[model samples]
Target: MAMRRTRILFMGLALLVLACGSTSGGGDDAMASGGSPGKALYNMNCTLCHGRDGKAGLNGAKDLTTSTLTKSEMVAIVQNGKGAMAAYKQLLTPKEIEAVVDHVRTLGRKK
Candidate 1:
């Protein structure tokens, strides 16, 4: 009986480890879906000003959900800084900036 209980305990622990390993905080899913990295980056950097859905407009930040800017235009503004917004050029890599831009585009589609 003692050995059987120990085996069961080990099996339960192993199952828990497997479950944890297969789960993520969503960052991996976002990347796997081709936009999660951008979403993660946006949440980290833009959510405060743009709001979670990009319509917050705090501190004079634009309502990205309604903006009609193209990807290139958005990238330029993000890289160069616009009005009250600080430039990300000194802070983020080009790829990261692009990811952020991609994330912003999703905001416009959220309704």
Candidate 2:
């Protein structure tokens, strides 16, 4: 009986180790289907002014949901600050900027 219990415990531990080592996918595995890669980045950086839905409009922040700016236009503004907004050029990479733009563009149509 003691040996059987030990074997069962060993098996459980083995399975747990295997599960821990396994993955469903690579980077961004938890991201939803069709979800933008920039969503997380936006949450970390832009959420303060833009909010989760991009409608916060706090502290001179524009309502991104109603924004009609082109992608290039938005990128330029993000890179170079506008009014109360701080320039992200010294902070985020160009790729990060593009990702943020992609995420922000989806805000208006989310509802």
Candidate 3:
């Protein structure tokens, strides 16, 4: 029992260390240099389901390239929740949401 307890304690300590040591996806300087905070946050939290390119098709994740919703509508959808999409009012700030809206708007601009 003592050995088991020691193992568990060690595991917990290791996990805590790793969590603290892990850096955000990019460097802090990068974020400060006009990096899109919304894009970074979205990439970290939403990309898996929404797709890295914003066209994941996961459970019909809407293609931002074709979304007709205005910025206000997008903000509403992000903050108030829409269909399967979760509300991010608490998770993201208005500034971050604007950044995300901007990034989403560029999905298919070249094509």
Candidate 1 weakest lDDT stretch, 10 residues = 26-35
Could you say which candidate leads in lDDT?
1
Off by over 4 Å in 3: 1-34
lDDT of 2 by residue, 61-99 (tens): 999999989999999998997998877776667887898
Residue 31 miss distance in model 3 (angstroms): 14
Residue 106 shift from truth in candidate 1, angstroms: 0.9
Model 2 scores a TM of 0.68
In the range 33-57, model 1's lDDT, one tens digit per residue, is 5535566567667776899889999
Q: Which lDDT value does model 2 have at 104?
A: 86
Model 2 lDDT-worst window of ten: 17-26
lDDT for each of the candidates?
Answer: 0.74, 0.73, 0.62
lDDT per residue (tens digit) for residues 1-111 in model 3: 995565356445544533443544445426333555555555554665577677776876787767788878987887777787766666566776777677666664644
**TM-score winner, 1 or 2:** 1
lDDT of 2 at 81: 79
